[model samples]
Target: MKQRLNIASDTRINALLCSSAAVLLAACGAAGAASAQTTAHVYTMTGAASKDFALTGYDTNPLAGAGSLNGAIASAAAGAAGAQPRLLASVATANPSSSAVTTATTEVTQLYQSLLGRAPDAAGLAYWSQAVASGVPLSAVEAAIRSSAEYISLHNTAGSTVTVPATPYNYYVSPTGSDTAAGTKAAPFKTLARAAKAATRAGTTVWVAPGTYAGGIKTTYSGTSSARIYWVSTTKWGAKVVPPASSTNNNAWDNRGNYVSIIGFDVDGTNSGSGTKWTHGIYTGGSYGMIADNHIHNVAKSVACTSAGGSAIGVDSYYHGVMTDVIGNVVNDIGPAGCTYVQGIYFSTSGTIKNNLVYRVGAVAIHLWHDATNVIITNNTAAASNFGMVIGGGDFYHTSAGANNIFVANNIVYDNKYGISEQGVTGKQNVYKNNLIYKNTTYNTSLRNGLVATATVGSDPLFKGYSRTAAAPDFHLTTSSPAIGRGTATNAYPTDLDGKARNATTGYDIGAYQH
Candidate 1:
């Protein structure tokens, strides 16, 4: 005769508790293939074991319908609940490892698709195929998945070698060490000599911490195309709020004729630390490559040799192979050296200085002297300086000498005696287009050397801040700013400093800065 089934709430809860525990144990490969009688004991001990249901093993298979797993759980649950013997007898058996290969391949494919946005390469595909053919287990399969090219490709941005700060160098305090040892952050090497020695080798990196590294720091090393020395800020904006290290003497920091970068250092040459002896923040001779993104100022007292013709940041004579790029820097309050002469940036070569903000120097803001050829000075803002710009070949306006193809385009010159003076010898082709020359009580009779060039007269070049960040100078023209669309359309000037394309129909604006 067939019997009718009856179940109670207490019995059902007991069964669930027991079943969960058995599943956990079986998943751990524990009690391998328990006999019928042993399975009965697991069911009897369900209520006690179920208290530790939170535990999981690496081999635990959480998926439903897995081999032998469903029956093992059911048997344990029934025995714990003290259910009928016939119910435990009905439990099924399974073997899930038979399909492990298929599962691993699917997982590898998914990982590749997510990381590379494509399928694995031929080599990767072959490695997996061989491993599976050799009957590798699921754990081996996981390891293989991690070793694929996809894993390594994700970290490509850091390049080959990992970069860390030089030894004995502190992000907060001063650093002292040579560059040969590991350039670790805690124990950073203080001198550039140390960094250069290590950076010369390929796959090596020298990371500089943030501080006003004092002068005479120089380096001479040729980095490979793949590996280059990186001198960067340890902090965001690199403690920009703290001013450069003040000096009672001269030449706070002088790069002694090395063809490497002296960058991201806030060098202060203020008040002549030792007396009126040195006055150059960075005086470069025999230096080449690039000088970018530095905040240099207050070094005039040490540069007392300007009677020999020196500048605040002077580029010395015989500068061949000095193909340097000076961009995105802030130079302020310079040129208090012994001599009455001071220039924010003085160039004597075929170089480019763009997107720089310079103000309040003792003398001319920018001076270009002998043999300076093919120079392009654009998109720079100068205010409250003695003179805006002074260029001389053998002579200035005669442009017939060494300084030819000189283009002074897109500049904002304001509040000075003269806007720009190009006066010297002859035969030089110069273009002074799209400039906003404005608002100086000291009036000049001749502008652009009285040459027939394009400029805005009676226009006020409105600045966001006359003494602060001019990279994005908000020259939003007030009703009185006369410099609106007075620019030439062919010049292709940027309408916004944020690098948005300008509206050609509106015509170009008059200065390096546009509304």
Candidate 2:
């Protein structure tokens, strides 16, 4: 005969009599398989052998036919003094690694369908499945759904107003995992594709574990202005995306979603000797997004110069007036030498490009070409490129008129083929001021055609250790560096490249570093 294990009163009696914990557990150990029972919605585990869980509250689970799980009877006691208090039963399994995959998948799917009235996304399904597999009580899962924004929006009455907060989900990606695995920290997705497929929601964070992943991953999911999607490397630069030896994938990271944030990953193009060449190390074709604290390097072709190569970090705004900011990135070795079209950091649309270090690029260290306008280029250090920066518009505008209101301020443009130059139909209103333009092969500040840098200082920004060829060059300023205290408050950034806030009382410094 089928029986339900109800331990409302006996569990408390058991908790009080800790001496009989083992005896009570062996007899009621099958309580671990409990599928349903409105606990005063309470349970407890006393770190002993057996447990008798309490039953309370109304029958919150409308769906019937709960599955049986198979382990610890000690995990079934009810009361919130400690660990045993909150656990419901599990999916259909007793342990996480057992072959209850069917039961786990089914139960999680059932919850998604019943509670949200829709199929669970890959990420959600994976999370719930892993939760159930790890012996998360079904009632807790159900309660989580009940508290979700989707459920509240679906079940709200006309007269009643409910404000259920959206669940912030986190999906994991690792090289050891498979695409089919539940995208949990315990069972992470193997590839960016799988993680992307699972993490298709606003406020979702895709945590990339330490491992080398294939390049050319495209992010197409969008998040709202209030809730942005995040793709983060768990360890800073530990998660590397190397260019595929041979594939049609051009960009290492191609983001086409609005309000997406890509943070703390290393995109290395050094392995792109074969197959489809890597164009952009990190490219964003979305608006209201951010590409921050990333290292992009070696975005160059094996062959001689060509116009087909792209920037190390390219930002394009799909929607006008919505900006995609590029901040705190260290970009270098971006292109083959003497390639005029290549760039370390390039933006064709509007964005706040600040607090970046660009060195050893092919063309312009930081180039603002094409339709870029209303752009803020500040708090940057550029060196060892064809041009420290070339801010101009191309034929994309198809007029004698160039991009307008381009603000360039508080930058250190030094030791390049040419220093900060402007070659466009710029208006007089563009704020070009407070820059250290020094020691270029050609001109220092070529601001003709209605573009000029006011208070442009041609001083050597003394560095801690200035080596133009070092792989890890120190761009920190000495105390007596002329760039210090020379920056204007107009268009000055709030933080330095190292994320340290500038001195509130003291004036802001120039270059990527504050002092």
Candidate 3:
């Protein structure tokens, strides 16, 4: 007998054939002698699974009550175990449950919204749906989406705003002003401490005019994530903050607030004599703050209390926050001789140190210690220091494990006692790459206790002109310098110290210059 069958267009099925009479002959042709001796019939579907269909056996034509080819294939698969060529039909006819579709749809929508900053298009929705249906986990899909360049760009600009208010909320400070005066530009306040005390709300900007200000500044005012409070100098290096002559342990400026900014001032830590106590130029105990485009220098601690060291810019996470930004500053003459613990830029937790010029410091130019993690140091110039950079371990009252996820790249370290040193557990979780190290006294790069640099270049950086003894030094790179095109391209900063493009061409130039 000859028989014919038709299956649905999009449905798939699988079946095992046990008899030659049940063979799936094309065009209902008579079975050959070899086929008649066959013990099994095999049928496979295109995309759908046989297990997805529930089928029943039928003694007569398997396609009799089969609503579609899918049903016919299901019926054939259902009777594959029987001796007789029995047919089977699909039992349930509905698609996947509404709950499953709804869940998939919700996930797709959220992934698009969070990762891409837009709604999903039809093609994208279909692609992700098929991917999920094919056993791809939603979390994996979300991770891939978040790792895209689009998501990175969006994340970098997440809390920034564009619209400027017509009249900014500003308070003014001046040397010849009174504390009782209104903080307006016409009648400014006398002290930064008074201005800070009055500017309590987010988006408040305290503008300090030209002149030297005495006394330490400490504030506890916090700002919102989107609108940060700013303490700015009207003229760079013109507004100076100096510690009181009698104060021993006072910092020039101490901020303990979150989401604050200190910009474009000069902090002078006057190291009068050998017995002077420790004092920092700018000490920050808050998070989500910025210390940028400032000049901090002359910080020191007395040898009598050598353990009480200070730093030019110190960031500590005593207020339970992270993400401080220290960029584009110049720190010089920090840690006079015989002071073993002074630092140029000292950070205790998560932060970024980039595009700064730090020179002539007594101790480490940049220090990352005390449970610091996800800290990045890049594109800075550190010369004439005891150590260029130190990723600290459990030394000097820091009992925690060393820093984790520390990245040091594209820096110029020269004329220092040690180029880069890793002490204690700090060396274990660090990545050092693309740095230009030369002319150090002892070692170019030291990873003590079984640590190693991920990548390093120990050679003369070939700068335009640099001298450890010169009255004024130049750090720009020459055209033929090896560091001209040797840096690893990074998204940490867009511009170098001299305001040049960080990646003007194919590759980034090492150190603080983009030549």
The top-ranked prediction according to lDDT is: 2
lDDT per residue as tens, model 1, 1-515: 11111111111112222223222211312122211111111111124323211111111232134432344444434534533222211112222243643564565555444333345544444333333333433333333333333333221212111112122111112355544445544456665545545455433334445454445444445433343334444432242212224434344434433444444556555533333444455565544544545567654533543554445566654544344555545677776522347678777766776655567666777777766777777766666777778766653222346556677766777876666777564233777776666754464324343465566455666544443334333444454455656655543434333333444676555454456
* Ten residues in sequence with the least summed lDDT for candidate 2: 62-71
Candidate 3 C-alpha lDDT tens digits along 1-515? 11222221221222222122112111112112111211111122222222322222212223344342344564545634421323222222223345654677678777675444356655446534433433335653454444344433333221121111211266779998889999876788999878978989886777788798874778789888877887777666678887666664457788899988887788876644233344688888888989987889776644342566778899886555589989878888887663558889998878899888898888888988666778899989899888998886454343365677788888888889988887766645677888888888898888755656655667787777787756557888888777777788764477776666666565788787677
What is the RMSD of candidate 1? 18.0
List ranges where model 1 is wrong by over 4 Å.
1-181, 185-187, 201-206, 223-230, 234-259, 275-277, 286-288, 301-306, 337-340, 395-400, 440-450, 455-457, 465-515
Q: Residue by residue across 485-504, what tens digits does model 2's lDDT show?
A: 88877766677877666764
- The lDDT of each candidate is 0.46, 0.69, 0.65
**Model 3, stretches more than 4 Å misplaced?**
1-168, 271-278, 301-305, 395-399, 448-451
User: Could you give me the TM-score of model 3 versus the true structure?
Assistant: 0.64
TM-score of decoy 1: 0.55
lDDT comparing candidate 3 with the true structure: 0.65
| Per-model TM-score on C-alpha atoms | 0.55, 0.67, 0.64
Q: What does the lDDT come to for candidate 2?
A: 0.69
